[model samples]
Target: MGQASFACDPAQTRGRRVAEEESAFRSCFQRDRDRIIHSSAFRRLKHKTQVFVEHEGDFYRTRLTHSIEVAQVARTISGALGLNTDLTEAVALAHDLGHTPFGHTGEDALNALMQPYGGFDHNAQTVRIVTELEKHYADFDGLNLTWDTLEGIAKHNGPVGDPVPYALAAYNALHDLELHSHAGAEAQVAALSDDVAYTNHDLHDGLRAGLFTEDQIAALPIIGAAYGEVDARYPGLEPYRRRHEALRRVFGAMVADLIDTSRDALAGSGCAGAQAIRDLGRPVIAFSDRLRGDLKEIRAFLFQRMYRAPSVMAQREKVTKVVEDLFPLYMSDPGLLPGRWQRDVAQAATDAALARFVADYIAGMTDRFALQEHARLTGTHVLGDLT
Candidate 1:
């Protein structure tokens, strides 16, 4: 039940960028988690996209709900693997802080627009937000998170090979995140938790959106078996209940495989400390090959049936246009920007610097706010009769 030696211990934390007195009642990771939960960016996630835009439906997963689910999954995985749950939870919660309003669609659009500049990456934007953009504290421009949390956020997916995104690269120049190595145990757990949460909920959202039927997904691998098991247990269960039961089981299957496979790997790997886990140059947390294959099938099905479906594609185009419209509009006329943004706009040395600031403003917008701004500026309705 106790934390493993390979878990990151907050007491020996590498400390924040701007050193401060440690909290008497909280670990550094706990403070990081608390700061993230209370940040302005975190509050804006309620209107950001997951699979669908925020206004698509009340029941569909928003970025905020998806983050909470990922944090929940991370804690469960971290607890079972004897990793630091608080650190895992913090990384999980902060993982999507840089996502744009309309989700990947908006990001894709913004990236294309900024291609002449240094390109936009959600991961790099996340580093920018925590280390620079967030400006609540009097002492620092950004949240002065512990070195461990920043490292986890910088490369939770793995080593940041050549050509790292601009924001991450810039920050690493100031405070190195050890970009060539894997993140520590808790971060690895958070990354896998993101996979587990999104894969499961995308199915749930697809079903609820009526993009695909439960019977159709019942043909998929792990999901079909889950559906079959539910039918055997309760023959006449209602439709929604049946769907929920089967999907919950599918979720359990992913979490369990990750825990079981990862625990075996950890127990055998001889990683005596968190650094050893990072130094191993491979993922210590992962689903078994069978589950991975099953998940592949599920993901392919969802890609074809939900993500690229006609209705979703229509919505994607609309939001993409909104971002496309907003970016150049702001660039051509920084005068249109609010008074607070004007000082920064005036300070921009070059078009590239100005573009980065514009991207930052656009990236911070929520879906509804983006829509409102697009309407306000362009005087054109982007989301037309979107469900």
Candidate 2:
């Protein structure tokens, strides 16, 4: 299929923060994707948590695996809808770059701790990572990605306004991302792909962890229908195989629905260009109302069964304390930070600035590194056997 009328055209990208010569072999979006893949922040994701902690199990998803899955799903959907697959893949791969060590639990703890210091938002942190954190470039502080790539990453979730996170606001002051308007259709597709990947994989993970059984999941709406079909087609299939078959069906259904729904929305909107889709003030990529309702039911089940289950909650408490302890300790004694980070700490003129630097340092840590650092500092193991 040809590129969609509303697909982001690489030739027309808004360009990078620090101007540089164009690549001889790669399009702007491809260059952005390559840069993200090679970034130090991206490498740290292997040790970051998705739902379960990194040490919980070898089979459980880590941020690195989850991002790869999201990229695969996004590429499939973007290809089906004739969207810009390169841009969509870039957004999907980079979306969670700023997620804390212990999944959402660590993020919540950090946000609570940073409430007075402008608060923590992963999306904003992601913006900060690409704009200022990755320091390999001699010319620029961050990756110096194209404006289109940056806009997609920053606004992939939708329009952001009022009380913007400090990192994003500061960057926007220098290079505006048009925070009040929607991102391109490719970015919208990447955002939805994240939901698709996490929902399906979490269900698989929950079942694998034995927090919830196939019988329990079979009671949900769309997933139930999928299980029913699986059982009917392959009676007496092994339990593990049965679960895989049912969940794969659920995943396929979601991706298919998203493609069809997005195609219809694009057709109805008459968006002849990528910017027109953004100016429409609504996402052109989304699941249908029926699938959205079904997903809501599934999310509720996951929230109650897997996320809130006692074992997971216990782990959350442990990691929360690790972040909570590390933040104030570093704030008071910035000398504890690594030598490079200590230089920034020394440069911090005010307590608030020092606190933010500490936040950045802690946020960048992997789960095991955070635990090790906490143990080193406090002379106690926070994670116990999990470490």
Candidate 3:
């Protein structure tokens, strides 16, 4: 029998066996772990933002660091709970593959530009990246990732609608929808792990940025208690080393608490095995009452000090303006798009196809590429060689 700790039914891969020649130390999940490590999207993370831009400070967190933290937290919790560490690490690593250059600001801009089209969502875009965008095999267009990984990416947020029917469903009745929605527990864990990673690490980054001080952070009881716990556990490390390790420990505690709380809550509710139980729709964090209260305070701290800080807000507004102005220009002059886009626009196909193509062209851009495109189309700013 297949390993049963994780959620995705192993049968779904249709016995498409992982080759035996692959590393003996690697389980199916480990193979997936390696696949994600080798992806180009994974590398682009170094250039992406977490909270502060990478160029802003030497100590600031970038998207790459953020992913590493998420993987670290997820692996810890999965190891504790006897879940598949490799799978959790893979999911966390690939989670933000679709995030744009300027962090959420960039994503927001793209979403507005593509709103008339199928609307932009980083999570949804991540699915597209693995399934269609990352051109690898000549026979298969994208990374031929297992359905488990796709499910984790697609339904990580919990249940939305019915699982889309898969191929050959009910004798062609479900032909149009070739894949089932992957609203499973593993997916939910991936989503929750992302929350755990950011909520804690963002605070750490803010502190590093001098946007908030440790005393300010310690004002929140949950964080304060978590910090104390770490200090008590690791008493002999150097002061600087202790503080850094303490932050990671705090993140771990939060994740562990949330996972335990969530698992118990779901189990007690008689919804343990039901697919819908895992897809919580909104950003649900399974924490205790006290922890929940403290986390809100933490979020408030970020909103006031980090997200709404004058420097960050100024950049956010600039991104909004660039995206807003440039989108109309592209729509008006479809010729400005790449040759493939030009032909598609000329054909005037169904709106869905048109929208998908527009999204594709827009989503594939690097930060500098988007900026240059904005400048070229709107003539508001001059282009530079330094992307």
Report lDDT (CA) for all predictions: 0.92, 0.92, 0.64
Error of 3 at 2 (Å): 12
Give the C-alpha miss distance for residue 102 in model 1, angstroms. 0.5
lDDT score of model 3?
Answer: 0.64
Q: Where does candidate 2 have its weakest 10-residue lDDT segment?
A: 378-387
Query: What TM-score number comes out for model 1?
Result: 0.98
Q: Write the per-residue lDDT of candidate 2 for residues 145-177, one digit (tens) a residue.
A: 999989999999999989888889999999999
lDDT of 1 by residue, 180-233 (tens): 999998998999999999999998888878899988999989888999999999
Compared with the true structure, what per-residue lDDT tens digits does model 3 show for residues 1-387? Answer: 233333444433322222233346656666777777788888887767766644456576677788897887776665554445666677888888888767888778877766665567787677667766677766654465665665566656654344321211221251122234434555456667777778877877777767878767766767677567767887776865766776766776777687777656555545433244344333332577877777788788788999999978876787667667666666666677887557657776766456555666666565556667777666665323334
Kindly state the number of residue pairs that clash in model 3.
4
Judging by lDDT, tell me the better candidate of 2 and 3.
2
